[model samples]
Target chain A: MTTLPTPGAVRLGLVIDLDICVGCHACAVNCKEWNTGGNAGPLSDYQPYEAQPDGVWFNRVHSYEVGDGPAGQTVHFPRSCLHCDNAECVTVCPTGASLKRAEDGIVLINEDVCIGCKLCSWACPYGAREFDEDVGVMRKCTLCVDRIYDEARPEAERVPACVSTCPASARHFGDLGDPASDVSRMVADREGMALMPELGYRPTNRYLPPRAKGSGCSAHAKSPALEPVMPEGTGFLGWLDRLLSA
Target chain B: MHPALSVILFTVASGIGYGMLMLLALFLPLAAGPADRLFGAVSLGLALACIGGGLLSSTAHLGRPERAWRAFTQWRSSWLSREGVLAVLSLVAIALLTLAWPILAAPVECIEMTAAIAGLLSAATVAATAMIYRSLKPIARWHNRWTVPCYLTIALASGGLWLDWAGAATGVDFLPRAVAPILVLLAAVVKALYWRHTDGLKSATTIGTATGLGALGQVRPLDPPHTAANYIMKEMGFRIARKHAAKLRRIAGGLGVLAPLLLVIAGGMVPALDRSAVLLAAPVATIGVLVERWLFFAEAQHVAMLYYKADAV
Candidate 1:
């Protein structure tokens, strides 16, 4: 069961468009608000109001300055449990608390069976799982299992908190098993990529390639609808960019 | 990554135990002294204590202590299981040799040969323990020929220290003052090689490869798919303080290798200095090795670290 599942088969996944994301951090805040109030109560912050804030969070957004000069800029990366098919965390667990659901291909933790050893935390490379110090157990993103299947919630908003709250429509969720599903289609059209696939984790979530800032001919980059030739770079924007670089 | 005190104690204590016993066994090839029996017995006892206490301490890290025995059954494939098996085998070999001490002292070459065989078994068992780490291919730092030799050296060094201390207590010269320099030199070379090998390694995963788009010029994490820190980050994403690591490296090098080497050289040179000086250096060198081992683990960056953008960290 721990063997990695085939790509675009039994598992459902998400394809997030990073190019359109406004870095509002709505996904992270909504995720915390929903999960803490749902099945897993209180994500347990260890000094919420202090200078050094630390606690168990199922999702985290890291803002980074990736490059330098005119071609480089800031990028916001949000992290969550990958729900990997290989799932090393499951095998490393002394208890059977860590498991991947066969029915939905979603990895989950049974809080009751967990003993707070934190071995699964080490086995994972993604930094996805968080230890609930108060309860003495590991907690992670369940891909909003409770919300997605909740009969009480509206069917239209049944997706994960991060997916539903994306004001820029950057996040998409559907069955990756169906090649025609929204997620699958987006991956094919936008050239989506798996995070750390070489580790053989086979994570369910996919990250759509960041769109190139300018028009380019490479398949990985976005091609402009119509090509234009700039006249000796005389624009004010180009002048400012040159000045900044100088 | 969590740095559990019990595990640290378990590994360090057990590493010392097996390492000492292995060394004593190696010394058997040099000469079998009258006090060798006493040395063997004390070292065996300490090794057993370490193994037993270590197993108990390791249980503190398990979710279900009751399932600990299940690990032993998986030795056919698991390094963890092999480690357990080797620990038991070493214990058994020590027991067999201890029982045959009378036969060994009977002034018969045959009896001495049998006792020597037992010593070989003990050494072999400790070597097997070292191989457990060496066998893990996923852990690039652990999978190497040097790992076993380093472990053997540490074991011998620890045992020699014990024997020297015991001999000093009973007015016997178990470890000659001349032997310390050689031990320090060997240990230093091994440590240096391990550091050099691990330092020059490449990141296991690149941003381009991670996303399965090998042909892509460059791929950076734009919007990470989630909001919270999950299991992977808590475990494999651990990072150490660079400033403290640099300081500790100097401390470990000085104490574990350099100072010990100087002490041994000084002990060998100065006839006026008592054997106690050689004996004193053992504990000092051990404290140094312990700090060195701590840094070894703390400084090791797992291949999985690339997923967390640790290159930037």
Candidate 2:
């Protein structure tokens, strides 16, 4: 049951645009809010009001400063389950609790059967799985399966909570299996990259690189100032006539 | 890579248990009459207790210990499941051999055949356990060719010491006096080689490679997504200081290998001190192996930490 489906299946995944992401953390927050009430609910937080608070979160955003000084850029990377084609997490599950959907290729864990040995988490290179200590089960991003397929919700809004809630429009959700899909086209156009392709996970999600900064432009480039117009006369009518002529 | 106590205990105890069981199975044909029956009973009892206790202790670390039985289901894909199955099969074989030993006295061939099967199964069970860690490609320290042999050698060495102690206690020189010491030396050499190999090795992935940003200059973490520690940080980002690690390695080496080697050699040379020497070596060697196991988990580096700007995996 843990065996993966054939490659090039309907791999529903996300494509994030790093150039526009401001690291607002709205996606992470919305993920927590929606998933806590959805399939994997109540992502229990320990010591909520205490000095050290810990909890399970399906998605996390990591900000890294790449390069140095002039060429440096702060990259905010939001990491979640990539729903990999060759997911080791699923294969390493001793119980058949972890499964990859042959239909959509979304990986999921059966909480009822999961013994919570933490092997799946260790097997994953991306740190996609989250152990829910309270429920004594492993939790991960389901790609909002409930919302995405629910007929009750509006068709336009049928996307992952993280993708829909992103204020900066940094996240895109579509079938990555299709080469001609919108997300795939975006990836082709922008040269989207896998997070750790060297690891050979074949992650479905792709990240668009930030646009190269022009040599003349600075981090805080300002618009050029307009030349000052000399007033022909001290009167308002004369100033208006000079401004109109200019 | 957090060296959980339950797991450390499970691996060490079960390894020794399985090793002892295998040795007993190999020598089952020699045990005969009332005294030998008592000896076999006691030896087999010890093996079962150690193996069963260790297996039970492993479940204690699980979040849903009650659902542990389901772990036996996925043997095709999971090493842990295969280990569970093999452990049960070996136990069953040993049990059958033990129960039928007295009744099957007429045919020596039957006993030998059963013992052979049981011994092989025991060895296979230990191998399955080793593969659980060895198969993990994400951890550079554990996923290596040396891991399997190192585990097998250590198990045999520990088992040999226990067998020596048991033989000395029971006044039966069933095995050669030199066997235990020689195995201990071999285990020590293999372990040293494994350490040397891992020490010079570099992680396959670098921080830049992890982020797919190797084309850019040095990449560093400006800010972590969260100010507080998360599950990945707690589970995989465990770090040990170099000084402490060095000290622990010395301690493990001295207790696990050197002291046992000296005691076993002294026992072999002096007839009078044989019993006491082996008795002392058993506990000392166990503690050493325990420390070694702890270092194994604590030293492993998970590749996931690369996202946090870890210099290496």
Listed in order, the DockQ scores are 0.16, 0.68
Best by lDDT: 2
- Tens digits of per-residue lDDT for model 1, A1-246: 233234435676677776676688898889889888989767877767766556777777655445445556555666678777778676555456677887777888888776666656656766677778777778988889988988998899889989999889988888886888878888889878787665676777887766767532353455456554654366897798778868
| Model 2 chain B weakest 10-residue run by lDDT | B31-40
lDDT of 2 by residue, A1-246 (tens): 776667655899999998888999999999999999997798888887778778888888888787787888788888899988889899889999999898888899988899999999999988889898899999999999989999999999999999999999999999999999999999999999887786677888898887787653463577676676865577888888878888
For candidate 2, write residues B155-233 as lDDT tens digits: 8888888887777777776666677778788988999998999888876687776666656677787778776788888
**Residue-level lDDT tens digits of model 1 in B1-313:** 3345566666666666665555555555466445355655655666667667876887786655565664454354434555666666666765665565533443434335545555566566557656655653335566666777776676566556655655655565655654545666776788778878866766556644543433434435555443444444445544563338778878877877777667666766785554666567767877877776666556655544454563532
Tell me the lDDT of model 2 at B168: 73
Point to the candidate with the largest TM-score: 2
TM-score of 1: 0.73
Cα error of candidate 2 at position B23, Å: 2.2
Model 2 reaches an interface RMSD of 1.1
User: CA lDDT of each candidate?
Assistant: 0.65, 0.84
Taking all chains together, the TM-score of candidate 2 against the true structure is: 0.93
